[model samples]
Target chain A: MKPLLSVRGLSKRFGTRVACRDVDFDLWPGEVLGIVGESGSGKTTLLNCLAGRLTPETGSVTYNSAAYGTVDVHDLSEARRRLLSRTEWGFVNQDAREGLRMGVSAGANIGERLMAVGARHYGDIRRTASDWLDRVEIERGRLDDRPTTYSGGMRQRLQIARNLVSEPRLVFMDEPTGGLDVSVQARILDLLRSLVGSLHLSAVLVTHDLGVARLLTHRLMVMQGGAVVEDGLTDQVLDDPQHAYTQMLVASILPV
Target chain B: MMDTISSSSSGPKEHDGPVLKVAGLTKSFIVHAHGDLALPVLRNVALAVSPGECLALVGPSGAGKSTLLRSLYGNYRADAGSIRVHHDHAWAELVGAEPRTVLDVRRRTMGFVSQFLRVIPRVATVDVVAEPLLRLGADPAEARDRAEFLLALLNIPQHLWQLPPATFSGGEQQRVNIARSLIVDYPILLLDEPTASLDAGNRDRVVELIGQRRDAGSALVGIFHDVGVRELLANRVFEVSP
Candidate 1:
């Protein structure tokens, strides 16, 4: 079967700087793909291209999705692209603030997405938001408080719940664990692993942490400069790195 | 009664205690416009920061994280609590400090970065970054020099420094927000979701900058949603529960 998401020779540039070059990949359902790289390695640039945040300089992103089948994401009309962003695709940022409106309460943040996709009944939206907050391990009483009051870990989880509440087919996470503590990072990783597996949702995670990549990704892609230097099963890449950069990265990580 | 703050910017003396202290803090709004007697937003929340420590606060959404941070900086008045800050290097209560003292503490000793970048709609980025310094009585030339240095350190594009941050990307706006915070040599820094709109790389950069600030002897209280960020940046962590 064709993969759910297919990218063919995708490329993006910011004036003289090439953010991504000739990127090609296939993301299947029920799999987490990790993209790891240093700053300016273009890992995030690729994710944005796939998420429809940035238009590609070349090539195409084809989505064989359950709701909208076999269409070029880049070629979709603005309205269709918005529909894709709203209903089928969920993009989680490294910063929870970006993922939510700080002015609104936690319930509203989760419900806004639902409302965007034609969920009008106020009671239903509130109920769904409450359910998601509970699912993400947030207490019920604080649903009316703005996100600014939540801690970093809680905010990130809230962002995750907000995106997942709509049951998006695929979610994009950018450094979801980049700024957390060891204990908190572990819990979040465990939560993400379980959620991704149990829900059978696909994810594209961008991170510089090998531990995070290992915990969540089935396949790992090592990006250098502006291109994918290596791609293989996560265990294979970590256990026996092929590329020099990947080897260096694996060596830098503490052995379990 | 909440502690009272002194009204001057004299150099430090030995009798002063921790820069900020809050105990048994609680706050709520009536929400008269929406409904009468709405629920309280914060309850029995207690936390503190010394002269040079970055305390990271962690909680799920609606846990009163921002309220806790804002109340400390004197933005929101606590309904039933006390916040004592030894401003002016002398012992004093910060709760309901005089306007001059409040302004003094905010201008010279406290720097706040909100989640949204609310730069003057038409102001130049350089001017925005230097505003805090100017308000603190730094010479215009010195303020401009400091702003330029900080912006360069944060890797903000030179040409864009003069352009309104409204035109910048989320990541760029966040950088400017950070620069604005540091423009004044405030002893304490309050950041509410400082990296909320950035990508992996930009988020890391923002974290790095905050780490540097903490190292340079600035006390920090930051509210963040990303666990990775909190772990990397904070030496101490506090979890808030409803």
Candidate 2:
């Protein structure tokens, strides 16, 4: 089977400081691959490069696009990439406020995706928005409520519904569960797991939290100094971490 | 039934041939921060289990018993050699296999009953147990029915079926874990101390369930801490040393 996303020799640097260096991997369908490291490890840079938000210094980011068969994301025109971002892929940002429109009603936030795919009927759009709200565990009555009125967790859930409402096959998640309290994080993690399974999503998740990585990812790549130090199955990487850097990262995890 | 010892160059070969085989499998962890020192755990291990048979792994702590099990399940990558399982009528090489292939094999042919249940917050116990069937495209109602059947057989009361397993007692959680794995009658099963937390009655029920799987020709490998459980379920015993 062809990989949904293939990244090879991807490197990004800000002047002399390297962010990503010679990173390569293929993300197959229905798999969640996580990139983990401390703050400067360049995990987010790698994700941005994959998402076409950051242009890399060298190498290819090829996506087996559902609409545009096997295209290099960086080579595509700006309009084409934006088209893919909405129709073929979903990007869930770490900050809910950034991902969502605070001024629009929660219903409009979700209906916009369906509308992007040429959803034309008024009743159909509203009905789908209402259904997605329920799927993400938001109150149906809050369809007209702007995101500003929602709590942090509700906004995060609303952001997820908006992204997933379009039924994109691959999702790029940057710390989807981060910055939330432990209890809220657990709820979001649970929702994310179910959504990934039911939708058969292939995701590239970037996070500094190993616990979130363990719960959501099938495979893990550990980075240090902007280079991949280890890559393997999540449990193996966590339970029998092969690299010294991975071991230190695992050890530094505060015991729950 | 107790004569098999397979660490030697030539392992015990089942008459029908082993359903699972491992040869020259080695796994080590390198401490790159500690001047690149390597901590070797599983070293050149070889074993095989046949259909309708249960092989018990007996070893002291830090002897890589659990490591070997996880490696066979493709949780850990072996440095050298192959761990192959006969699945869907062919030997699928697990070591260094693609992640997707490993996942497919796990979904259809092999089952691992970890020590505890990984509760998904608000998911009901029955849905948790019925999940494998759901993934296989079973009807939701039919899947729930089978889940309820297994839950009852494992002595999990009906009322508890609607509740999540997170707050359940240790024994109950383990039973749910076992039921969830057994939902599909996987061709090969890797068990890690599955009955450790159960009381005598529940232990007997679990022993009986595992016995039924073996009787139906599911090759099994496990770590059995209880001597009686070992005697009742193991067709042979394989010993590992650190």
Candidate 3:
């Protein structure tokens, strides 16, 4: 089967510092691939490179888009890449505040993506937005409230709802549950698990939490010093880490 | 703990090779506050379960019974060994398999029913049970209908079907959890204390459900606390100890 996204020898550098190097893998459809590493290990940089946010210095990032067909992400024109971002792709930032418009009501936040994709009926947009809020477990009563007033978990869930409303096939998330309470994190994890399964979404999730990686990802890449040190199934990598860095990372997880 | 295995059609299930095989698995739990005191639990535990068999894990408390269950499910990081699961008509290593491979195995072949019910808050009880099918891309209506059927079979009141099971009694919650696990008809099933919270009647129903699964050629490995349930369901029992 053709992969939804393929990468080969992708490298990125910031001045003299290597941000990422020689990253290569294929993200299959409906698969969740997790990138795990300490801060500054280049996990985020690799994600940005894959998302076309940071242009790599070398190598190709190919996407087999259902909408645009097979095309190298970096080769796409600025307009087309932007179209791709607003259409078939979704990026969830580490901070919900950065990913969402705090001033707008939750309904509008979800509706904007639909509108960007040519959805214009006012009643239908409102209904769909409300439905999305429900899907994300946000109450319909909160649909009119600005995200700025919501709790951390609610805002994060809303951000997810906004990204998913337009039905993007692939999603890139950075620390989607990074700063939440443990309980809230479990709730969000559950929501994400169901969403991924039911929607058959293909995703690239970047998290330092091995627990999160174990729960949400299918394959895992352990990043160290901007290079992939080891990659394999999430359970295998966590349960039997072969690389010293991967072994250390797995050991670092506190027992619960 | 109790487990049962109804081996395959050959001389024995072992003749066909167990569908789930574990060998040389070892693990230790370290207590960090106590100066990293390592508590070694499972010590080179080995077992195999063939299709149409139910293998039970029976042992005293602290005998690492639960640990063995979790290790078999790829929940624990074993110090050494292999958990070879024969799925999709091939042997896939679980001890060090990739997350993608493990998830794929879980989706299509294996089902693990832990003791508790962990569901998204506020989702209907029937919907919670229907979710596995939904994730497999089944029609939402058909999935819900099958969930309703299971709930009815398990004696979940029709009036409470739309309400979340989070507020249900412990016994009710366990039944919901079992129904969810049984919904998938996985080729290999791992169950832990599935009937710990149920009454005799409901426990009997769970026994029948598991029996039906074994009859349908699904290999089951379970830890049942109830002796009656174990006797009714497990044809082969494997013992464990510290």
Candidate 4:
């Protein structure tokens, strides 16, 4: 099958600092690919480039959009890119505040995505928002409250609801379980796992945590410095890492 | 107290038939705005959960799945029924148990994970997760250490542990709520949509954690909408009708 997303010769740089170099990959429909690396290893840069958040200095990201067919994400017009971002794609930030509108009511934050997709009826939007809240495990009673009043976990859940409310086919998640408590991360991981399966979402998950990759991802790409050092099936790579860097990464995980 | 009927000396062994038993459990709500209209949420519900068993409640919305779970946890009082929980070597009736008995049961025998996390403003995330152990008279350091472990397992960053959960995200708060409940190994566990907000990775961890608890002999009553998790943990399913 033709991949849902294709990245070729992807590279990015900031002045003299090279962020990503010669990264190449293909993500199939309904496949979850994890980009794992240490800090400043270009995983985030590569993700940003693919998600169209950062314009790569070289290479191309071609997405097979349901609405627009196959198109280059970086070459699209600004208006069309915005539309794609709001409709076919979702980006979940590590920090909830970075992704969520703190001043808006939780209901509005979720409804806004639906509205962007041309859903205009107030009752329908409100009902959808309420349903999303329930899915994210937020109390429907807190629908009218601003996210600023929410706890960190609540805000993250709200963020997930807001992003997934429109049912985007492809999502970009950066350390989705990054900063929460252990038990909290477990619950969120469980929810994410279910959502991914039910939604059939193809995702690019960027994380430093190997455990996160092992549980959520089907394929893995280990990055060191600014390039892909190893890439293969998640279990195979984690179980028997071929690259020295991948070996080090796997060995570094503290045994539970 | 009826609880004294089966003191440790005379009570059934730990591997006895069922740790929890419910018979003819029924509940209804009166809506004054509708001229005292009676809304029957649950009726004639009967269930028995043995040690190491997980009984999942599955049904359509408003089918009273959550109501049944809450009733088991004594959050909602049943109008007519008996909720017999095997604790302190005896079966205590939860339906009309004294307030003190209910509180005592909650503290020592039951652990509930509600759908929404009730955040206590200004309480550090670590302390919030640790409070359950602390209440059980565990060493303060040990309690905090356990709290930290669960928090880390759930992916809560170490830096955020000292900060209050008030500023945390919804998922973050729910994690804390889960951590708090799981910290104490109560004999009976009641969970309401426990993995509803979690992501794919964390969800698997929760399934394993719940599996461990069930394997360790905790009788679990849960409303599991996630079929994957329900299948993984539930030994029997009780379907609630709308």
Best by lDDT: 2
lDDT at position B82, candidate 2: 89
* Cα lDDT tens digits for candidate 1, A88-166: 8888898989988999999999998898778999999999999888888899887999999999999999999888888
True contacts kept of each: 0.00, 0.48, 0.33, 0.00
Residue A170 alpha-carbon offset, candidate 1, angstroms: 0.6
Worst 10 residues of 3 chain A by lDDT: A235-244
**Quick one: ranking by lDDT, best first?**
2, 3, 4, 1
* Per-residue lDDT of candidate 3, residues A49-122 (tens digit): 88899999999999998887899999999999989998899999879999999999999999999998999999
Tens-place lDDT digits, model 1, residues B121-142: 4557998888776655667787
Query: CAPRI verdict on model 1?
Result: incorrect
lDDT of 2 by residue, A4-92 (tens): 98989998999999999999999988899999999999999899999999999999999998778999999999999998898888999
Which ranges of candidate 3 are over 4 A from the true structure?
A8-24, A36-41, A57-60, A67-69, A100-158, A177-194, A208-256, B1-48, B58-68, B76-86, B89-96, B152-172, B197-201, B225-229, B239-242
For residue B239, model 1's alpha carbon misses the true position, in angstroms, by 57
User: For candidate 4, lDDT tens digit of each residue in A1-256?
Assistant: 6789999999899998999999888888878899999999999989989989899999999999999999999999989999999998999999999999888899899999999899999999999999888998889999999999998888888889999999998999999989998877866776787588668788999999988887778778999989999876675567646566776777788975
TM-score, chain B, model 4, is 0.92
**What docking class should model 3 receive?**
acceptable
Query: Could you estimate the TM-score for every candidate?
Result: 0.51, 0.94, 0.74, 0.53
Candidate 2 residues lying further than 4 Å off, grouped into runs, are B1-16, B31-39
